[model samples]
Target: MKLLHYTYRKLSLLLLLLMAAWGVLFYYAIIDEVMDETDDTLENYSEILINNALMDPSVLETEGTLMSFYKFRPISEEEAEDYDEKYYDSTVYIESEDEDEPVRVLKTVFRMPDGQYYELELMISILERDDMVEAILWYLGALFLLFLICTSIGTRLILQSVFRPLQRLLDWLQQIQPGKELPVLDNPTKIREFQQLGEAAVDMGNRSYKAYEEQKQFIENASHELQTPLAIVRGKVELLAENESMTEQQLKELDEIYATLGRAVRLNKSLLLLSRIENGQYTETEDVSVDEVLDELLPDLMDIYEGKKIHLVRIKGEEPFVIRCNLSLTQILVSNLVKNSLVHNHAGGELYIETTSSSLIIKNSGEHPLDGEKLFRRFYRSIDGKKDSTGLGLAIARSIAISASLSLTYKWQEGMHLFLLVKESEKKS
Candidate 1:
């Protein structure tokens, strides 16, 4: 997958491992301390029971009387046995009067002034000790569980907030399109690393967009500066080929060279126009009618339409369709669409150009169908197996439309090819 995907997975894993290690250490440390404290309390209880039993002779016969002197009083006789089994390994006491005997494993001996000796012995069981340990463990486990729940929720919320801006930057980068302005990066990140990442992404996008602007400017300037020189060369070639000494074959070759140069000049001019449109060089915020420009370009299209027996018609709305746009660029857009229809139409075909308040619809009768999606792509030709057409017409028109914030579309319907330019209302001045 992607590096970002791998990085996110590794970060999540690291967090989980760290939390697990922390929980383990905390459980053992805290629970062990608690268990040790409980054991100390039990040891003190054992000593008090032993001292009280030796002090009162009656306590020796009845273990119940020993409860008042014990560190922790047994709740019941049954409980007392279980408690003794948990705490003592074995208990025995030698009478103080019998000072000669050694102190044994679980016994302490006491002797009275009357020469009477009392011995108290008891053994602790593993099961009762395990019960105290288990209690400590359950307390630790519950606390750890609460800590884990809080940390998990906090981690997700923190990560999402930290990565939110980066996600926006990623989405913006993915949506980069030629001839469009970069979108603004709005969300803020406070973490130093994430802030730096966001800054880098914004800088990269801005740099790329600036570079594209510079490249477009260069192409437009180069195309404009080269035009005069190219025309001069074509003129010189024509003048030379007209010399009487040149043979018919020589003149024919000269004519072919002139034709190729003419095509090159046309291509350069179209490319220059497209560059101008993308740069917004031709934009003007003045009211103009789309219908008026078509009136002017239709006559220019007539010469090409002649002898093809094709019909070119214009349908205008009763109300003037006014828009704030560059008249020169709009003319270029409309002219390209009309010329494309004329060039691709079948013999004796009909072409229609209509303008409404909100749109301009151009249609032509033609057998050449194209993938409507690909029609606006630069250098895409509608007709297959056709070598005579320059494929930049639609692309150029689209650039102009986009520069003016207009939407253009293409489709085939009812045996006729269609192109539409949907006008957007002008922004308030």
Candidate 2:
């Protein structure tokens, strides 16, 4: 979840728990105060009745008025010795009202003038008290609910406002690319920590871009510097091969040296191309059809590796796969992949090339699976790879694909090494 929602959820849960606890405590406190008031009223009423009954002996047995709700019972000395005053809630039925009335009851033991002990049971109606308590509970619940909702909404808004700066910084960071200039970050916040974070991010991006340029410049210059010398050495070795006085072993060694020198030259060129691609030096671009590039490269590659007798198979969709990329880079990318397959194939192996409107799949027959993880790393060659192979073909192909906004991936299927290339957008989609 996003940071805002995550924080909001936790805060709301804590608030709910705190409010529930507060509501419980407050509810009991109100109930306690109400009960105390009821008990006090009962105590006063009972005192008045006891005084009247002592003044007039018939008052206890009076049946004409509210006295019907009270009773006086004779008790023995033993019962009077253990008697205690009591107050509680109960209900009484009245035939005139046709309903039960809630009341507060008080019981006490009193001695009459005749030397007889009596127990007085007196009660007062509390129907209004019960209604007040019920009303308090309803309003209390409604108020708590309203308070929680208002606070939750207010808290969410505050959290969103508080985290706006961090969100802006994150958005700015996402738009910063390696070769492209970082976009302007216009986030203006009063917070000190967010300001520092934005400054740090911009500083890091500048330093990274500087380092990337320097690295690419070094690689390009080194590759260019090595080429002429490598060509000169090979030229001198070829001129030496013209001497007739040399023995068979001597010529054989010279050929081996020449072949090794050729691989070095190819490696230097591959590095130069890679450096150029990453530096965005090839600014010229066009809509290039992938199937067209494959068609042009396959003929020459097949002729060059004719001795292998590799069977070629092509599967094409009705619509052609096209991409927007530098023309030279596109050709190089296609050439490297097709050339690699031809050079690596064994005698009588198969080469399968399939194309769709958005993708290309090239599968070359192999004895076993290659290491998919390290297969694209520069100078990563299989154990039984051809001696003349430079090991930079697939690496160059992958680099070009990335530079052209495409994706190149590899897999092994059914004794074939499969290389797939597709536009980055289509691949992601």
Candidate 3:
């Protein structure tokens, strides 16, 4: 989830909980206040009736009147003494409505001037009050809903404005490349934390760019400096081998040294190529067909290993297997993979090359399977190592594939070793 949405969810939940708790409390408080007011009104009405009855006892004789609802009943002296004022809710039957309605009732003891004690029961209709309370509750609920909606909208707008700078920073970070200069961040903000984050990001990018430049320059200089010395050494060894008085033992030694120097030169060149590919130096790209590359590479490779009497088989799908990559790197990738197959194949073995619109597969008959895990590691030779093999061919192939956004995998099946290369886009599809 995005930061804004995540924050909003938590805030909304807390607000809802608070509103719910407040709503419950407000409901009870309103009801309690209304009940207290009703009780106070009932007490005042009872006092007024007692004062009127003391002035004229005829008012006590009137019962079941519209404005005055009360009943007077005679009580013993002991009963009047033990009586206490009581207030409660009850149902009363109204003849006009022909139904029962809720009311508040108050009971009290009053002594008449004739020395007789009586109980006074007074009731006030509360049906209208119940309706009023219901309306108030609904009004409160509506206000709560309106407040919730307004707060949600306001919070969303505020959060969006606050996070705009972070969004811009993310966009800037996406455009950063290993060899490219860092982009200028122009998102202005008043937030101190966001400003500090932007500064840290810019500093880190500059440091990374500097480190990358230094590493690339060092690799290029080292590779170039070693090339001349290696060539001179090999030339001297060749010249020494041609000496007329040199014995066979000495000549053989010179040849061995020359061969070792050749291997060193090849390893150095391979390492430099790998480094360049990783550094994004080969950026030029074009659509190249896998079938076309293999058509040219296999013929030359077959001629180089003709003494082994290998049979080459080609399987092409109806559609062409084409990909976008650096043309020179594509050629090197294909050459390395085919050369690896030929170098490890058994005598008079079969080499099968298959192509489809999405992938290329090469299977070669070998005496045994190569280690799948270590096959792509540089300087990893097979169990039965070849004298001329430098152990960098597959590693170089894998590096080229990665630079081209392709996947290269190795597997052993049946009695043959298989190398598969497929485009990442096609794999996803």
Best by lDDT: 3
lDDT of each candidate versus the true structure: 0.69, 0.85, 0.89
Top TM-score model: 2
Q: In candidate 1, how many clashes are counted?
A: 19
Candidate 3 has a TM-score of 0.77
Per-residue lDDT over 319-340 for candidate 1, one digit per residue giving the tens place of the 0 to 100 score: 6566567877777788888888
Native-referenced Cα lDDT, model 1? 0.69
Compared with the true structure, what per-residue lDDT tens digits does model 2 show for residues 1-429?
999999988987898788778877887797788779878877787777789889988887853244236778889989999999998888887788898877778889888888888888877776556686688768877987898799888998898899999999999999877677778899999999999998999999989888888887788788878988998999999888998998899999999999999988877787787777767778789999999988888898899888999999999999999999998888998888888888778899999999999999999988888998899988899978878777778888888898888899999998898999998999778
Instruction: For candidate 3, write residues 30-66 as lDDT tens digits.
Output: 7788789888988998888888888989888877565
Task: For candidate 1, report its TM-score.
Answer: 0.55
Per-candidate TM equals 0.55, 0.82, 0.77
Candidate 1's displacement at residue 27, Å, is: 25
Q: How many pairs of residues collide in each model?
A: 19, 0, 0
How far off is residue 15 in model 2, in Å?
A: 2.7
